[model samples]
Target: MGIISPGFFGRRRRDVPGLPPGQHLTEDFPVLSAGPTPRIREDEWEFTIRTEAGGAHRWSWEEFITLPQEDVTVDIHCVTSWSKLGTGWRGVSLDTLLDSVESTAEYSMAHSYGGYTTNVPVADLRDGKAWIVHQFDGSALAAEHGGPARLLIPHLYFWKSAKWVRGLELLRHDAPGFWESNGYHLHGDPWREERYW
Candidate 1:
């Protein structure tokens, strides 16, 4: 199962415009994780994308920071039913990273530093839809909030935005990750209320 917080059983969903169904607005950026937080040093951090054809494109912390960066202001929704709107982030677009790799794979498995994984379609990750964000709200993202770098796919449920993201493995078919294997929805689209199998 994914991160589950207490008090989720009885809260009423608010009928707020621009909010997903069955979700309520939240002003707090809650810290919920499947396990203990891993503290990674910046100097040792790296990101990679391994193609289905066995090709790998990698970047060290120094190299990644040198890539083009964008300021993104978007709304984020958590599977736990909390939605925070108009959050600010700065990072490199997934398009920029994918431009260097050549692959025909349609799926990807995002791997984080602490054994966490999540599957996302390559189509959902491209065309200005996603980013690998390192900063949140004008400051370095806190460790509890995915720290050095995290995948930021705000259009989907927050879980798709894997924190402490390390690399991505392009695959020929879709496969469930940590949460999906345990019965979470395969494609976690917040707007559609696709929260469970």
Candidate 2:
């Protein structure tokens, strides 16, 4: 709907020489606790979607590219105090992926390989806030920025949209993620400034 604000670090104007017209630089943002740093060889990276009713689907890097795509601008608010403005990202909507599968889970948790998990309501994924992003600023995502594939849920706190995400686990109830279980907020709606709860 609206790509609201910049990310955790600081916002900068797009003034590259010959990059895409509206493309922005998302690399300056910081990666909090990079999480043992998952290494992704071209053949090793994968994205999986698991349903509450026990159905699961996995996508390789190439396969992930075959899905429908859209470019969206969203406001990403990090738990820390920093907001970049008007970041452009391209990817498939989480709802589009869910529609391809059948699930009964009321809530879901995003799972990353290095013990990272972020909980979110199933309805939220259906809303425009969530996406399985592959491109940032018209460029293939760089590894440090969660390249190949990463979750983009801007409405919630940035931690909910994990970097280097490997899969999504649909749950019937809420579960705290790596930061959430520690000290981050449960329902990290930036609109309410619910950075933590």
Candidate 3:
């Protein structure tokens, strides 16, 4: 047999900075889908945003891809105690998505294609706070990891990122989504140890 490779026997800790409380560093991004991955082709994909006032903004795959895009690098912390640092992504900023719309709504709910929903503060998703990412690490995001597009709000726990993201709904009040309704923290802040009901 060939000689064994060095550093292949176990996980080594990286010098990741600003990790939230109770989180361990991980170099590899883990897969943690809650349901079957939906395979959406570029032609069949669409994104919509519905405001509480009943106005809807929609985008088709072709149109969505044509929008201005940006690249971002951030550290993401999952509620499960794993944090991945310096993850790279390319997508439209939430600010870009909300630019034309004007509203006093205080909360935004991200709705995913597979019926996954996660709510967050409207402010948290604006001012360069979040993104709707279609590519990660220079490749199209894989299905299991929220391919086609996913919301990336790094400041909050990973669950707020909303994998397989499809749209956003604006509301005057906070509304809990899947995990939130099921006992996960309504506003998950890793550094604050906000992980449960």
Per-candidate local distance difference test: 0.94, 0.76, 0.89
The TM-score obtained by model 2 is 0.81
Off by over 4 Å in 1: 1-15
Task: Output the number of the TM-score-best candidate.
Answer: 1
Sorted on TM-score, best first, the list reads: 1, 3, 2
* Model 3 TM-score (2 dp): 0.91
Q: Kindly report which residue stretches of model 2 are placed more than 4 angstroms away from their true locations once superposed.
A: 1-28
lDDT of 2: 0.76
- Give residue 145's lDDT in candidate 3 (0 to 100): 90
Q: Which lDDT tens digits does candidate 1 get at residues 92-120?
A: 99999999999999999999999999999
Candidate No. with top lDDT: 1
Cα shift from native, residue 128, model 2 (Å): 2.4
Q: Return the clash pairs for model 3, or none.
A: none
Give the C-alpha miss distance for residue 5 in model 2, angstroms. 27
Per-residue lDDT of candidate 3, residues 1-197 (tens digit)? 68899868645456456887778887788988788998888788889989989899998988888899999999999999899988999999989889878778999899998899999999899899999999999999998899889999999999999888889999999999999998899999888989999
Query: For model 1, which pairs clash?
Result: none
Tens digits of per-residue lDDT, candidate 2, 22-63, equal 334343677765456676665788888898888898888787
Clash totals for all models, in order?
Answer: 0, 10, 0
Candidate 3 — which residues are off by over 4 angstroms?
A: 1-16
- 10 residues in a row with least lDDT, candidate 1: 7-16
